[model samples]
Target: MVEVEAAGLIAIGAGIAVGLTGLGAGIGEQSIGAAAIGAMAEDPKFFGKGLLMTVIPESIVIFGLVVALILLFVF
Candidate 1:
């Protein structure tokens, strides 16, 4: 019974960690996306930089997923 409860708690924690990180990534990407669009509108040359900036925020979600996977499988 205690083991089950502990497992449930761990699952909950993993969910929260992934959820929060996803939320953060979304928020970060939103701003970057907006800026990228605006910059692209002004000058096409900015596309590369804007794309790079936009993708950087995506790493946050990847890291979050890794953390969740580790939590679920390791602990």
Candidate 2:
């Protein structure tokens, strides 16, 4: 019984880890994407840099997923 409860808690923790990070990344990406678009508008040459900047926030979500997996599988 105790082990079952522990497992449940771990699942919850993992879900929170992934969920919050994804939300945060989404919010971050929104702003970055807008700025990237604006920058691109001013100078067409900014496209590469703008795209790179816009994609950077997505890595946060990947990190979150890794954490969640670790939580679920480890300890």
Candidate 3:
């Protein structure tokens, strides 16, 4: 019973962490993506930098996913 409760707590916490971080990352990436596309439309040469900047938010979600997975399995 205690183990189950602890696991539940860990799951909840991990979920919350992932949810918040992912939400922020999604929002951030969307903004960057929009800007990147707009910039690219103006000048094709800006593609590299714009794309790089847009994908920068991926790290946040990746890190959050790592933490969430670790919590789910390790706990």
Evaluate model 3: give its TM-score.
0.85
Where in model 2 is the C-alpha error above 4 Å?
Answer: none
Per-residue error (Å), model 1, residue 46: 1.9
Model 2 sits at a Cα RMSD from the real structure of 1.2
TM-score of every candidate: 0.89, 0.88, 0.85
lDDT scores for all predictions?
0.92, 0.92, 0.90
lDDT of 1: 0.92
| TM-score winner | 1
Where model 3 places Cα greater than 4 Å from the true spot, the runs are none
Give the C-alpha miss distance for residue 56 in model 1, angstroms. 1.0
Clashing pairs in 3: none
After superposition on all CA atoms, what RMSD does each candidate show versus the true structure?
Answer: 1.1, 1.2, 1.3
Range of the 10 consecutive residues with the lowest summed lDDT in candidate 1? 55-64
Residue-by-residue lDDT tens digits, candidate 3, 1-75: 999999999999889878988898999999899999999999999999998999899888888888999999886
Q: In model 2, what is the error at residue 11, expressed in angstroms? A: 0.8
Model 2, global lDDT: 0.92
TM-score of 2: 0.88
